[model samples]
Target chain A: MPVITQRLRVTARLTELARVRQFVHGCALREGLPERETFACELAADEAFVNIVVHAYGGESDGPVFVRCRGVANGLLISFVDEGMAWDPTPPSAPPWESTETEITVGGLGRLIIHRAMDGVRFTRRGNRNILSMCKFRPGFSPAE
Target chain B: MEVKITEYKRVAVVQPVGRVDSNTSAEFEAELRRLVESGRTNLVLDLSKIDFLSSAGLRVIVSTMKSTRKNGGNVCVAAANARAAEVMKLAGLDSVIDMHPSREAAVASF
Candidate 1:
């Protein structure tokens, strides 16, 4: 399969969130990803993008966010790059679907959804930019869940 | 978010259409809360029309549920698609509130 990568740069604003989802949805569909898988990627990407706007840029609309969609074997990778405040590269550890027996709160759910929706997620800080990447694979082809 | 609220005898069904994200969650939350303040506390949130559910919207759902419950009211959700349902589950919000498959069922649950 041919590997293709696409990129988009948008201002860090809540209003830009839909455009970001549309960009990724179009790319994921063109890659022939199933609707469910495509939606999962969209949700994961939205969570990451929102975090960039809300946390990285502190809800400011002036900062820039770089979004990328890359095609890989049996899956796709969605990544975000932002020059907002430097954040530690720790992926959230929201418990899996079964063992979560804690009280539900309104806050801190954005990262939890991102960590759970995608097959794998990674974070890194390079120079002054914070990078987050989420990977999702087609069913039956996904490795080890 | 475009909200369509149908008030029943005891409960009201509030169906919000379109994406409920950071940009529109405030309006959505306001609409839901308005119904409560207007003496309609028991509510059924019909999510059949919501295309996307974000954390901002989830927070509104949670806070609304918490607030209403504290006031002897309750919120039930209806017609959430697979992905939306999964998002609620991931947030651990689904287990706390009532969930039904259809708007009528949810309203009748009151």
Candidate 2:
């Protein structure tokens, strides 16, 4: 079967987060992705979009966030490209689940979540645009040797 | 976000319909913070109506919980869907707060 793909583009406004969630969730469910994994994609994608708006663009509402979700070999790829400042979001480690005021308030918590909620996260800067991609693999599937 | 607060003698159950993401988290936080400041600190968050949740929403909860705890109060979760539950669990929130199967259970815990 050919891999199916869905894409959406929206301004870097907080109001646009809902559209990103629906767009990503709809694509996952339509492709028969499991419920657990479906939610993961929805969240990971949302986190990335928020990161772009809050971090990449400094809370600016007009910056455009280019989103593209496509089915790949044994997994789904949710990618975002934007013309915002370059900052790779790959987290070194997930914050301790301690829920302390210092831990959550110091920042990088969202990055930890985006990493833990998805199977893979990759980042690259292409000239002026930043490309951040996250992957969620199908159950009982593993990359071939 | 539309947040409904059902007040009881011991606890206030806050139900928010729709998504609690970056856009709406501020509103959600405001409602809960209002309750906390009003001395209604023990809170039961009925999340059944919540369609989606993110770190922004979780941040509000954590901060609110901290505030309530400072006043010898606490917060519990009610009817959180699997998605909401999973995210909370991922954050190790289950260790810090209680998550009940229903609003009744959540309120009863207080």
Q: For every candidate, what share of the true interface contacts is present?
A: 0.50, 0.44
Winning candidate number (DockQ) = 2
User: Where does candidate 2 stray beyond 4 Å?
Assistant: A1-5, A92-103
In model 1, the runs with Cα more than 4 Å from the true position are A88-107
Model 1: pairs clashing at backbone N, Cα or C within 3 Å = none
Tens-place lDDT digits, model 1, residues A1-145: 6678999999998778889999999988988899988888888888788778778887767899999999887788899999998654344465232323323333257788777778888998889999898888877884855
lDDT of 2 by residue, B1-110 (tens): 79999999999999999889888888999999899989998999998988888888888888888889889999999999887888887766777778899999999999
TM-score for chain B of all predictions: 0.95, 0.96
lDDT of 1: 0.81
Per-residue C-alpha lDDT of model 2 across residues A1-145, encoded as one tens digit per residue: 8777788889998778888888988878876789999999999888888888878897857988989889876768889999999875866464444545522552366777888899888999999899998889989887663
Each prediction's Cα RMSD? 3.3, 2.2
